[model samples]
Structures are given as structure tokens and as C-alpha cells.
Target: MTETKKTTEKTLRRFTLSWQLALGMASGFFVIFIIFAFVLSQILKQYYGRLPETLYQWLGITILLGGLFVFGFAFMLTRYILRPVKSIKTTIEAFEDDPMTNVRADRANVNDEFYDLVNILNRMIDRLQSLIGAQQQFVSDVSHELRTPVTIVKGHMDLLNRWGKDEPEVLEDSIKSSLAEMQRMETLINEMLNLTRAEQIPIENVQEVTEVGGLVHRVFDNFKLIHPDFIFTLDDDLTQDANVKVRQDHMEQILIILADNAVKYSLDRKEIHFALSQTTNRVEIGIQDFGEGLSSEDAARVFDRFYRVDKARSRAKGGNGLGLSIAQRLVKAYGGEITLESALGSGSVFTIRLPLQRENKNDQKLSN
Candidate 1:
């Protein structure tokens, strides 16, 4: 009942402005007509002795015509002012019904206030689109990432109960496998939390000059230490002069995530390649590995949080599957992009592109 009342009040308020303007115009015209009628009567009494019988009739006819004209003019003026507002209301209704609907208002030749409103609405729609896409991707990726660990945990428990009783060593191994699966689950949960935290924190405070090549080298060296069996090589294309404006820690984390994933998924003792190059406006970094490459469908979802191509293999290799997602987010935060190219059995490559800074060039020139 309260909601209904509130809605009715709102609708009444919307019409109030037009009605007020009409009433004001009507009052002003009435006052003017009275003054004119009084003046004419006085002039006739003075110059023509007394007013003729048709004088009153002619005066009434004139007033009636004037009132009609004023009414029409006021109505037209009110409608002209309210047209854009009505359009905005219709667009909002459509959006409420289906958010995917694109209802853009024409801004050309429009009043400045209306044009500003249209621009704001367009920006709001763009943000809504991004948010909805992210939400859908999160749901799909989380489902895929959870399934493998649950299956493995169940399988290991079953094995432990069946053969574990007969062989002590088998029981221990089964228990260990279950523990490993749990650990994988824990890691996945941690990665998800980290990703969420990263999304929530504003990046406004994070500004610094970052050396692109040096950051990549540090990440590579760290990965080499962690996965000693994997052969890693860095291309010399990236010079010491390559630098960009970004948060240093965030850039390092992005590189580490990509390089770490490459090392983890690559075949044992296989070579992983890291390459970097600078252009006039941007810098590109690539990480490639000879691993069990993904299918087209997998490639499409690799950057989604918690999505993995090979479920069993991903669990066996202890991947939470959020590395690429985190890496992509970090890259985008720095006004950069991350893309993947992969084929089954051949290999996979991940590339990152970041915008170059003027300060970087100035620094390089000074050093030279």
C-alpha cells in the first residue's frame, strides 16, 4: 500500500511542472484582458458618449479567441520541453525489463543537459555489460575447477578403503593422494580469494616506473628455481632500455603468474621460451611452452578464473586454474591486454601488451 502511494505521488510530481507553467500563463493573460477591457470602456465613455450594444459582444469574442491561442501555445511548449525526458523514461523501462537491450538516445542537436544525460547512460550501460560478463565467466569457471578435485578426493578415498586394509603401503599412498587433492583444493580457494581481493582494491595508489625486461628476468629466475627440471630461455630482443610506467610489484606478479603457468604445464624437461619487444607505443611479452596444449574451446576459457582444459591433468599437476585470470586482470589494470594462442599437442603461447611511457624514453636517452 505504501509503495502504491509513493508511485502515485511520483507520477503526480512529474505532471506538476507542466500544470504549474500552464496555470501561470493563464493567470497572466486573464489579468491583461481585464486591464484592456477596462481601458476600452473608459475610452468609449469619454469619446463616444456611451458604448454601443455590440461592443460587449465584440469584446467577448476577442477574449475567447485569445484564450484558445494561449492554451494551445502553452500545451505545445510544455510538450517540447518534456520530449527528451519521456524518451529517457521509456529507455529506462526497457532496460529494467531486459538489461541486454541497447537503447541509446540521439544526442545530435539536443540540449546540453539532455546530451550530458545520454553520455552518462551510455557509460553506465558499458559498465553493466562488463560486470555481467565477468559474473557469467566466474560461475562457469568455478564449476569446472571444483569438479576435478572433488572427483579425485572421492576416488582416492574409495581406493584407500578397498585396498588400504590389505596393504599398509597402499593405504599410505592412498591417504597421501587424498591429502594432495585436499592441498590442491586449498590452493584453488586461496587463488580465488587473492583474485577477489585484487579486484576489490583500487589501483589508483599504485604508480611507479617499472623496468619491463628486468621484471621479466626476475620472474623467469624465480620460476627456474621452483621448477629446476624445466629448461627456460629468455630472448635477447628485450633491451635494458625497455621500461614502462606501472606499479612495479603488480607487473612482476603478472609476469610471474604467466611464466609459472607455462613452467607448470610444460612437458618434463621441455624448453619454455620468454620473449619481449618494445614498439613506439607499446611493449609485448610472450611466454611459450611445449606442453599438452589446449583445444580451441579450452583456449577460449583459459583466462576465466578456475577454468582448466584438461581436468585430470590440471588436478594432477596441482593447478588452481586462476593464474591466467589473475594475470589478465593485472595486465588490464596497467592499461595492457593478455591473449592466448594454443593448439592441442603442439604448444601454447601467452602474450601481454602494455602501453609505453614518455618518461621511459627520456630516461633511456639520459643513460645513453
Candidate 2:
């Protein structure tokens, strides 16, 4: 019991980080002051030895002056050293109170490691805000997109309930339309789930270096088979193997999304082009179609979730407008970028750029 009591008292004596720092600095200064006073006392005693009666008085004066100097200097030093820490704490408290506040720590004038910490914290706050915005947008999109099919199903059911069941043709039409709407709702839910997963794919799953040329050609073959009516062609400018760090599924999904979009829009031309190019720093895959192109305003938002440049055309092609969005998400998650270019009368091209690795020594030697 006595040992436990002593341990508890010791723990209670522990100071907060700021207090600990102040106490440590004060203790160090006090130690030095004690040593200096001791040395001065000896010197004073030696010089005033003849006046031995006043020896005690001189020593006391020396100790008092040294104690005063040490205490005052230590107090100011501790406060000055911890000023940045206090500022960071206050900024954090303000941010917690109002997340949208644009409060930042004092980093511009100060040059210290704490500046790095503050910069990181500010970046985290920005990312948090972006995530919250994305989440709200996602919820709004789901609500808006699902409303059409839901309304259609409900209206048809109401019609059937109101004497439409007695008519054979109306009964059959309502049943068929309700079933179709239900299927579309199911697909929408699944695609939304896929979009969410695309945003959160495990990075470890995409750490492997994949040769992109072969993968592109494989997709070309698959598309050729899938859309035999359309001419599928591959144009390559690969002096060497173009490689990117990505998973096979990620590569395939992105290619299929672009190729599918090409096929959908190229109803008149019945041809799709796949262009693959490689450079020292990056690899590019372009999916081009000679179809009715989009205006600049629509092209700018091609990858936006549930955005359709031509709503009727997209619906006819059975596109919920999530395919390109998912593709863009996957590409970005793998440290890559996807872009679209189009003139209103001409065709559109979707290009993907992924960082490339330098040629290895063995590949260089083999080429030589």
C-alpha cells in the first residue's frame, strides 16, 4: 500500500508537455546558477577573508542576485520557445469550433520543424473538406437519379390499381414496364456501389508493374469480338514496352469503359480507334471515335458522376453515366489522369496518361 501510494504521487507530479518543458529549462538554469553562486561564494570569502564577520552577508547577497536573474531569464525563455506551440493549439481549437474557418498556424514568418507540422495539418483540413463535399454530392446524385425510375414504377402500379388490371393489354404493359424499372434500379444501385469501391480501392492491389501495350491490345481484341459490327483498330508507337503500376482489373475496367463509350457514340461510323504511345516519362492510351461530338461545356464535365451530354442518347445506349466517372476515379487512384477532347462536329478522344518507369538495364542491354 505504501509503495502504491508513492507511485500514485509520482504520477500525479507529472506535468503537461508545456509545463514539463518550462520546468526542465528552469531546472537547468537553476543548476548552473547554483554552481556559479558556489564559485562566487568561494571567491568572495577569499577576498573578504579579513572581514570574516561580513562573509555570511556577502554570500547571501550573491545567491539572492543569481536566483533573481535565473528565474526571470528562464521564465522569458520558456514562454518564447513555446509561443508557436500555443498558437498551433489555439488554431486547432478554432478549427474544431468551425471547420470552415480558414485558420492557419504562423508558418510564413517562422522557420522551424513545427512549420512542417502545421502545413501537414492544413493539408489534412483541406482534404477533409473535399471528402465531405464529395459525400454530399454522391448522396444528392443518388436521390436525383433514382427518382425517375421510382416514379415510373409507382405511376404504373397506380394505373394498374385503378381498373387497368381488367384490360389485358394494360396489365401486360404495366407488368413489363415495372419489371424494367426495377432492373434499372438494381443496376443503378450496383454501379453506385462500384463507384464507391473505385474511390477506395486498396493501393496494395495495384503495386505491380504491368506492361500496358499487351493489355491494350487484349482489350482491343475483346472489343472487336464484342462489337463485331464495328471495326476495331490499334495504332501503336511503342519503341519499347510501356509499363505502368496498376492491377489487371483496373487496366481492363478503364479500357472497357472508354471502348464502350466509343462504340456507343460511333453508331454512324461503325469504327473505333485505340492509340497507344510510350515516352520516357509517361504512357498514353487514346480511345477515339468518329461520332457526334460534344460541345465544350458538355465535354468539360464528361467524367462527372451521372452527367450526360445527351440524356436521350445516353439512355438509348443504356448508359447511366457512371462508367466514365468510375474510369476516371480508377485512373486517378493509380496516380494517373484521364482527359477528353472533342469538337462539336468532329469525333471525341478520351486519353489516359500513366506515369512510366525508366528502361531497366537489362532491357537496354537487350536492345543494344
RMSD of each: 5.9, 7.4
Q: Output the number of the lDDT-best candidate.
A: 2
* Candidate 1 Cα outliers beyond 4 Å, as residue runs: 1-21, 24-62, 95-109, 136-144, 147-182, 190-209, 236-249, 290-307, 329-335, 340-346, 359-368
| lDDT for each residue of candidate 2 in 103-212, tens digit (9 for 90 to 100) | 87777655476788878887777767666666776788889999999999999999999868689889899999999888988888888877877886656566578899
Give the alpha-carbon lDDT of every model. 0.78, 0.82
Cα-based TM-score, every candidate: 0.69, 0.79
| Candidate 2 residue pairs in backbone clash | none
Best by TM-score: 2
Off by over 4 Å in 2: 1-28, 35-58, 108-120, 164-171, 193-206, 359-368
Query: What are the per-residue Cα lDDT tens digits for candidate 1 across 115-222?
Result: 889778777776676666566655675686779779988888888778879999988888888888788778877777667545543456666778888778888888
